[model samples]
Structures are given as C-alpha cells and as structure tokens.
Target: MFDLIVLSVFNGLIYGLLLFMLSSGLTLIFSMMGVLNFAHASVYMAGAYFAYSLTPYLGFWGALIAAPFLAGLVGAAVERFGLRHVHGHGHVAELLFTFGLAYLIEEFVHLVWGRNPLDQRPPPLLDFPLFTFAGIDFPAFKVFMIVVALGMFVALWLILTRTRIGLIVQAALTHPHTVGNLGHDVPTVFTLVFATGSALAGLAGVMGGIHLVTNPGMAQALGPIVFVVIVVGGLGSLAGALIASILIGLLQTFAIAVDASLADFLRLFGLQVTRATPGWEVWSITLAQIGPMLPYLLLVLMLMLRPRGLLGSRDS
Candidate 1:
C-alpha cells in the first residue's frame, strides 16, 4: 500500500511538472499580453513536429535546441502578421481568430504528418532507468522533464520579477502609452511575449512529445487542461498556474493509482451494494475509470467554490 502511494507521488510530481511546462507558457501569454491565445497548444504541437522533422538533419540534441527557437519565430510572425491585424477588433475577435487558427494548425499537421502518432522516443542518452523506488524504476527521461520544468519555473519567476525587460513586458499591457513614452516599443514587446510564450510551449513540446504522445490530436488533448490550470491558478497568475498544475497532477495520479471502486468506497463504511442495489451501474465503477474526468470535476468545483481560482486575485 505504501509503495503504491509512493509511486503515485512520484508519478504525480512528474505529471504536475509537465503540466507546469505547458501551463506556464499559457500563463505567461495571458498575464503579459492579455490575450487568451486559443492556439497555444497547437503551437506546442507544431514544436513537437518541428523537433521530429529536424532530428534527422540535426540529431536529437540539435533539434531539441532549435525547435523551440523556431517555434518562437513562428509565434512572432503570427503576432506580427496575423494576430496583430485582428487586435483592433477586440478580445472576441482575437479569440475567434486564434480558435480558427488552432483548427487550421491541426489540419496542417494532419495533412503533413498524417493521423498517426509519431514514433518519437526519448533520446538514447536518457532512455535508461534513473532509479528504482517502491519496486518501480523511474526513467531518466522523466527526471530530465522534472529538472527542466523546475529550472524554467525558477528562471521565469526571476526574469519576470527581477529583470528590467520583465518589468517592461509586464507593464506593456497595463500601461502601453506610458511604456511607449519611455522609449520601449509596446507592440514589439507584445510580439516578444507571444514568441516567448510560444517558445516555452515549444520547449515543453520537445520533451512532452516523448513524455506524452506526439500526434495530431495532441493539442486538442491538452488545450483544455492548460486552460483549467490557468483558470484554477488564477486568470493571470504564474504562481497560481504552478500550484494548480501540481494539484491537478496529484489529483489525477491518485485517482488512477487507487484500486478502490464506488462499491469499495461503500464497503469501507460497512455498506455494501450488490448487483441488485440501486445505482449499481454507478457504484460498480472504479476510481481509475474516473481519472480522465477528474480534472474537469475539479474545474467545476473550483468554479463553484472560488471562481477566481486557488491563487487568483479578485480583479484577475
């Protein structure tokens, strides 16, 4: 029992960190630019594909370094040529544009990569087991994911709170004219923020393509969860996003790890429901079956109890 729980904790940490890698980028875009980029996950998918395509030419290491940068450049171009044109039309327009862009990006991926999931395995250098705990071996690749996520989190916090460029980026949305008067280009800042956010997503993709699945449906699978993380953490709060990511990650891990069913849950309280009992159909279900739906459930509960999220400000 203890071993199962321990294993679950480790799994939860890895899952949570992965969520952070994706959510942090979304959070940065939202908090800095005030744009709810619907295509963020699509960009992440593009990054994964970008890395995959580059691997043959550059090898895994080169692709890993280059793909995110390429993704960033693509993001900058989108903001400059596509999104900026729609910026004048208000948030609804921005949302619609990005939402459409997401579909377009998905179709493009499908047309180019086909519907099959890529055979994107972890690089040979990091494929071995790093350690064993609770009789389960943890992979080095997953440990790398954890380290990268943590390093990015710390680095982002420092850059945002302690750096001059961070100050300018943060202020650009709230005080554009003021920033412009100070000799900074507000539009350029917005482009940089979008690119940076996309780059973060791309970075996540480079690792996540292997950590998770790399497929055409990859963006659709994760897009909603990223939004959930951001909303649960707070609309524009990076710290909130991180906390929510871990919470959701742990919640999901435990749900899938536990062997208890609704029937077992009742038996724990000396109550047993047989096949003839009322709602047997429901009671027969196991928590592992509920794993996929847990995040949305938490999302609903979060909205009801505290709509702003775990660490969101009242105004946010």
Candidate 2:
C-alpha cells in the first residue's frame, strides 16, 4: 500500500509538471493579451501529429526539435494574420474566434492524420524501465518527460526574469501603452509571446503524445483538463498555475491509486446500510471510478471558494 501511494505521488508529479509546461505559456498569454486561447490545445495536438509524421524521417530527437518550431511558426502566422485582424473585436470575440479555430483545426487534423490513434512510442533508447520500487517499474520515457518539463521551466524562468526582452514583456503585461510610448514594438512583442506560448503548448503535446496516447480526439480529451489547471491555479499567475497543476495531478493520481468506497468509510463509523438504496450505483461511489472527475470537482470547488485562485490577483 505504501509503495502504491509513493508511486502514485511520483506519477502525479510527472503529470503535474507536464501540465505546467502547457499552462505557463497559457497564463502568460492570458495575462498579456487577455485572450483565452481556445485553440491552444489544438496547437498541442498539431505538435503531436507533426512529431508523429517527422519521427520516421528525422528520428525522435529531430522531431522533438523540429515539431515545436513548426508549431511556433504556425502560431506566428495565426497571430499575424488571423488574430491581428480580430483584435478589434474585444475579448469575447477573440475567444470565439479561437474556439472556432479549434473546431476547424480538429477537422483539419482528422482530414490530414485520419480519424485514428497513431502508434506512437518513445525512442528505442527510452523504451525501457528507468527504475523500480517495490516491484513497480518506472518507464524511461516518464523520466524523460520530467527532464524535458524541468528544462523548459528553467529556461522560461530565466528568459522571463533575466533578459531585456523579458523586462519589456513584463512591462507590456501591465502597461502596454507605456511600453509602446517607450518606442518598443508592443505588437511585435505580443506576436512573439503568443507564438512562444503556442510553441510551449505544442511541446507539451509532443511529449505527452508519447507518454499518453495520440489520437484524433486527444486534444478534445485533454483540453478541458488544461483549462481546469489554468482556472484553478489562477488567471495570469504562473506560480498559481504550477501549484494548481501539481495539486490536480496528485489528486487524480492518488484518487486512482487508492480504491475505496463511501460505504467503506461509513461502515468504519458503524453506520453501514444493509442494502443498496434505489438509484445507488456501486461504481459511482468508488474512488477509482470517480478519479477522473476529481480535477473537475476541485475546479468547481476552487472557483466557488477562491475565485482568484491560489496566486491570481484577477477575478477568476
């Protein structure tokens, strides 16, 4: 039991960190532009498909390098042509535009990749188990995920805090008008930031595709969970997003790891019911069964109790 718990926690950390990689850019984009990018996860899906396509020709490492670059370039084009024209329509319109784009991208992906799950796997070098604890093995690919996520986090932190461009971005987040008055190309910064954020999402998609599954519906499946992370972490606060991601990650992991029931807890309290009541479903009350919904449960509770999220200043 203890080993199971430990492994679950490790898995949670891995999952959480992957989520942060995707959410950090999302939070930044939201903070700077006040645009909730509905197509962000679609961009991530695109990365996975791109990587899948490149793996045969370029190999895994090459695909890792090239896929995100392609995604970022696509992002820049979207911003330069699609979003720039819609900027005048207010945040709601911008959001709707992205939402429509998401649907279109999904159709495009289906048309291009076919409506099926790809047989994607990690490179041969990363195919084996990394380590074992209490007879449970951890895969090398999962370790690779942790390494990549940490690298991205460190690089992003450095670029955002230690660079002159980072300073300008910080300024633009708060005072775009002032940054513009200072003779910096604020729109250009916006474009770069948007592209960078999309690239990060694409990277997450690529890595996650190997660890998780890559399919026509993968984006639709993961998109809501990513949104939950951003909302629960707090809008525009990377730190909050990080914390929320870990919390949700651990929550789901542990929830699935431990299989128990509300009835079991009630029995311990000497309040067990003798029979199943009408409309009662055994699986409905099982922790493992409801594990998938844990994140959404936390999302609703967090929004109700702390609308500003763990680190957010803005109204959630």
Candidate 3:
C-alpha cells in the first residue's frame, strides 16, 4: 500500500509538471497583457491534431519538431490580426474574442479531424516499461514525459532569469510603460510572449495526445480544468501556477488510488445507516467516484479561502 502511494504521488507529479508547462506561459501572458486567453487549450488541441496528421508522413519526432512551430505561427497571426484589432475594446472584449476563437477552433478541428477519438501512440522506442518497483511496472513513455517536463522547466527558468530577453520580459511584465518609454517595442514583446505561450501549449498537447486519447472534444474537455489551475494557482504568478498544478495533480491521483468508502467512517464512529436511510448515501461514496472532481473542488476551496491564490499578487 505504501509503495502504491509513492507510485501514485510520482505519477501525479509528472502530470502536474506537464500542466505547469502549459500554465506558466499562460500566466506570463496574463501578467504582461492583462488578458485571460480562453483559446489557450484550444491551441493545445490543435497541436495534438497537427501532430496526428504529421505522424503519418514525418513520424513522431518530426511532428514534435514541426507541430509546435506551426502552432506558434498560428498564435502569432492571431495576435497580430485578431487580438490587435480587438485590444482597443477593453478586457471583456479581449476575453470574448478568445472565447469565440476557442469555439471556432473546436468547430474547425471537428471539420478537419472528424468528431471522433484518434488512436495516438508513443514512438516504438518508448513502448516498453522503463522499470518496476514493488512488482508494479512504470512505462518508459511516462518516464520520458517526466524528463521532458523537468528539462523544459529548467530551460524556462534559465531563460527567464539569466538572459537579456528574460530581463526585458520581466520588466515588461512589471513596468511595461517604462520599458516602452525606453524605446522597446512593447507591442512586439507582447506578441512574442503570446506566441511563446501558445508554443508551450502546443508542446503539452503533443505530449498529452501521445499519453491520453486525442479527440475533437479534447479541447473542451480539458479547457475548464486548465482554467481552474490558473485560477487556483493565482493569476499572473508562475510560481503559484507550479504549486497549484502539482497540488491538483497529486490530489486527483491519490484520490483515485485509494479505495476507502464513506461507510468506513461511519463504522469507525460506531454508527450505522441503512441504504434507504435519509443522508445515508454519504456512506456509499467511494474515493474513485469523487476523484475526478478533486481539482475543481480544490479550485473552489482555494478561491474561497484565498482569493489572491497561493502566490498571486492580485486576485484571479
């Protein structure tokens, strides 16, 4: 049981870190531009579909290289054309525009990829198990996922902290007017940040497509969950996003791995309730049944208790 718990925690950490990859970009864009990108997850879905189409001809690695570039280009175009035009309309308009873009992307994906789940698999090299502990096997693909996520995290940290570009980005996030006064092209910086964020989403989509099933509805399915992560992690705070993502990931993983029921609680208290008894249904609740809602539940609790989020400077 202890081993199982450890394994579940590890798996959760992997998922959370992947989520952070997507959320970090989002938080940065939000901090710098003050826009909540509703279409971010849709771009992620596009990455998956783009990879799927590319895999038949170019293979997984090729798709991995090309899909994110294409997605980033798309993001840049959207910012240059669509967002730039809409920026004058205020924050609500910007958000609505993104929401509309999300809907359009969903429909476009259905039209192009069809309204069905596509079978996506990792490269043949990643098909086997990496190792086993306490008689439980861990797949090589999952290990690869952890490595890739960690590498991205380290690279991103270095770029944001060590380079001139990173310094400019940080300044833009906190003092955009000052940066602009100093002759930096603030709009250009914003566009680049938006594109970079989209690229990160694309990377997550490609990895998730290989790990999870890909379908036309995948965007809509995961969209709210990502939003919850952003809100729970605190708006515009990358560190908060990292913490929230891992917290939600582990909470869900452990919730599903455990098997205890609410009935166990009643028994411990020397109380009993029949199936037909009023309020007795609580006794029938199982961990698995509630596991899926764990993230949302955490989001609600966090919002209620700390509106600014764990590390956020402002309310989401």
lDDT by residue (1-316, candidate 3, tens digit) is 8789879988898778778878888888887768888899899999999999999999999998788888899889999999989998899999999999999999999899899899999999999999988777889988888888778778877888899888888889878999999999988988898898898889888988888888877777777777778888887777778888888889888988888788776778887766876876677888878998888887888888997788886655
The 10-residue segment of model 1 with minimum total lDDT is: 307-316
TM-score of 2: 0.94
C-alpha RMSD of each candidate structure in angstroms: 1.8, 1.8, 1.7
Tens digit of per-residue lDDT, candidate 1, span 184-246: 988888888889888988988888898888999889888898888987898656788889998
The local distance difference test score of each candidate is: 0.86, 0.86, 0.85
lDDT of 2 at 100: 97
What TM-score, computed on C-alpha atoms, does each candidate reach?
Answer: 0.94, 0.94, 0.94
Displacement of the residue 162 alpha carbon in candidate 2, Å: 1.5
Tens digit of lDDT per residue, candidate 2, span 213-270? 8887878887888888988888877778888888988998998877788777777888
| Candidate 3: 10-residue stretch with minimal lDDT | 272-281
Evaluate residue 93 in candidate 2 and report its C-alpha lDDT on the 0 to 100 scale.
Answer: 85
Cα lDDT, model 2, residue 154: 81
* Alpha carbon deviation, residue 44, candidate 1 (Å): 0.9
- Give the candidate order by descending lDDT: 1, 2, 3
Clashes of 2: 0
Cα lDDT for residue 228, model 3? 76
